[model samples]
Target: MNRKNKIPKFIFYMIALWTIFSTAHAEEIMPKAFVYTEVQNSVPFDQIPWKSRNPIISSQPGFISKTWLSGSGNNSVGGIYSFDSIENAKKYVTKFFPNAVKKQGVAHTSRIFDAVIVEKASRDIGSAHFGGKISTKPGAFVYTEIQVNLPFKNVPWQQRNPIIKKIPGLLSKTWLSGVNNTVGGFYAFDTLENAKQFAIEVFPKTAAKMNAALYTRIFDARLVEHASRGMDSPFFQ
Candidate 1:
């Protein structure tokens, strides 16, 4: 082939490869958005470093939302952290909970889920007063890995939305199913007691009715940042 012809072909190939790479990694690492979560049993509030809140965090920079979740068990703690960049998320975790990634024991399970969808609230539930940093007391992040028998597309959306709209203290919900038949979701609640109630009272009858296996965990969690999607997305309000 001539030099001119070869150059055009090379440019085409380069563009193709870049497109593929970008699409593949788009959801895995959102445009400066990531979710970090950890779940353990009965993590004491004193151990977490980021305590006491100042309203300035939301005003100072990029997205920031933080809260403690409540699950059915009092002995469990699961923390959820999100940030504008992967570097920021990692730095916060390393600086405060340096040992957060390690396995403390059989009972303690710590995790960080960076691949999550940030959704917006459906109702007029949010205000500037309610916004900003509210991680006053350190608590656990609750995570339940749900695998329903039905495909995500086939799940009952009409029934699910009504229940989600009523729950309070639920900061964020992540719908984590890709092109697979089985789907997953990660929820960041403001309090463990509310999380526990939802898990026990709501999830069973609606979301996990046909699930073959259900996994639940908790951790000592701190809210590093909290930025979520807009009201356009379809989820519990």
Candidate 2:
């Protein structure tokens, strides 16, 4: 099917799966925390030690998701990867990339940080393509992408729901899961400035609290447009 047709079909499948699995009472899953190291003055796009390791690692059982390599734009050698569960994710790291444990005369380094999936939502319709008539103005709508690790297995929906409501400038929020149940969420904001400000001011405070409960790493970015074009979509409303 074409991309347009796939959207609705994908939505339907996701909803059906959600209805079936919502009641399973599974534990909250978290991804392994790891940093991909790149040399500060390395050659551009040249093959390196870990260059081919990503595909091999991502194909493993517990692998949640992996980002594609950026060729020219943002030529950083590092990217994020999520896993189904912390234990499995860590096992994979130790088994496959033992050298990552120590920088040990290596040109690059990898460090694993503690992480947790705070939320997961499915059947999300892209806000940019929702077909609803909404004004797009400066500071009209903003998208906040947050990655934080928090403990508290089976986080009380009561606690999370209230927190979502309290976030300033949150027009809407949605949770999502990708391959192997990588957990994450997205928040819509009234303005780009509002989204940026929240990430700068409120997110760190929240992360600090979350880290106290569970070791956590965070990545916060603002979406320029709301077309839902990225992999992170389909789960964020």
Best by lDDT: 1
Error of 2 at 30 (Å): 11
Query: Mind giving the per-residue lDDT tens digits that candidate 1 earns over 141-172?
Result: 44565554445456554465556656765654
Instruction: Give all TM-scores, in the order shown.
Output: 0.43, 0.37
Badly placed stretches (over 4 Å) of model 2 are 1-54, 68-79, 98-157, 165-196, 207-237
Residue 41 accuracy (lDDT) in model 2: 26
Count of residue pairs whose backbone atoms collide, per candidate: 29, 5
Query: Cα lDDT of all candidates, in order?
Result: 0.43, 0.40
TM-score of 1: 0.43
User: What residue runs in model 1 are displaced by over 4 Å at the alpha carbon?
Assistant: 1-36, 39-41, 47-74, 85-142, 148-159, 166-195, 216-237
Which candidate comes out best when scored by TM-score?
1
